[model samples]
Target chain A: EPEVTQTPSHQVTQMGQEVILRCVPISNHLYFYWYRQILGQKVEFLVSFYNNEISEKSEIFDDQFSVERPDGSNFTLKIRSTKLEDSAMYFCASSEIADTQYFGPGTRLTVL
Target chain B: GESVGLHLPTLSVQEGDNSIINCAYSNSASDYFIWYKQESGKGPQFIIDIRSNMDKRQGQRVTVLLNKTVKHLSLQIAATQPGDSAVYFCAETPITDKLIFGTGTRLQVFP
Candidate 1:
């Protein structure tokens, strides 16, 4: 089956530096989303993208965070200034519609 | 506040037995619900889903029950195996198409 793929399975970055996590969603999917899971915490929604724009975002998705579909297949999340609290496993998901989301393996971000 | 949650934080089951994980959702307007399994260091894998219009749905080795009146959902795994060990989560999406996730329940299948 076709699956969502994420690059850089794990990343380590310095605090105050910039980081970008990349994802390639299922080819035919129209809606894309980003979610994060802190250690020992529930997975939280970050943002949703559709029709080439952001549909909704949570408080965690502040000005420091931005998502881009720079190409037909790539969805990228960039953090302007990383913080220790920002370290978590970031998952990218996509669906033909919003009801059933298929997730990628996830990218583990570690900021020291 | 979280829109969905589990009744138990952890459950242990013997191999060959059946495992039932329960979740409660607060959104009366939610139209779709999904259960996911996440292993260590991986993402949430889709297990099964049910729409508000249906009371029950079945997949291979799994079943989902939805009760609109009580705002509850549950996943039942038949013939539980050690490979089934993972953290399970339930997510709800209202008509607006935004997903709200629940706190997960860890399942351990003992040999």
Candidate 2:
């Protein structure tokens, strides 16, 4: 079965630095999403991308956060300035339509 | 805030017994519901899903029950095994399509 894939399984960055998490959703998928889960916390929605534009976002997806599908296959989330609280497991998911969502293994971001 | 939640935070069951994990969602506009299982270090893995039109869906040894009137969802695992130990989460999505996840329930199966 085809699955979503993410790069840099784990990352360590200094506070105030910039970080970008990358993901390649299932090839035929039309909708892609980003989510984060803090340690011992529930996963929270960050943003959703469709047609190379942001369809929706959460409060946590402030100005500091941006998502880009620079290429037809790559979806990237960039944090202009990393805060300690930004450290979490970031997941990328995609669906062909609006129903079932397939998730990637996730990228663990650690900001110190 | 409208969100998906679980009635129990954890459940313990014997290896051969059946286990049920429950979740409650507050959004009436939600048309899609999914059950996911997350291991200690992996991402949420899709187990089963039920659309608003359906009340029940079964997959392998797992079954998903949806009660639209009550806006509740439950996942039942039959013959629970030690490998079933993990955190299970229920997520709901509205027409906008962004998934709102619930606080997961940790299921422990003792052999």
Query: lDDT per residue, candidate 1, A1-112, as tens digits?
Result: 9999998899999999999999999999999999999998999999999999999999999999999999999999999999999999999999997779999999999999
**Per-residue accuracy of model 2 over B3-30 as CA lDDT, tens digit each:** 8989999899999999999999999999
Residue A21 CA error for candidate 1 (Å)?
0.2
Error of 2 at A35 (Å): 0.2
Cα lDDT computed for each candidate against the true fold: 0.94, 0.94
lDDT (10s digit) by residue, model 2, range A40-93? 999999999889789999999999999999988999999999999999999999
| Regions more than 4 Å wrong, model 1 | none
Global local distance difference test of model 1: 0.94
How many backbone clashes are present in model 2? Answer: 0
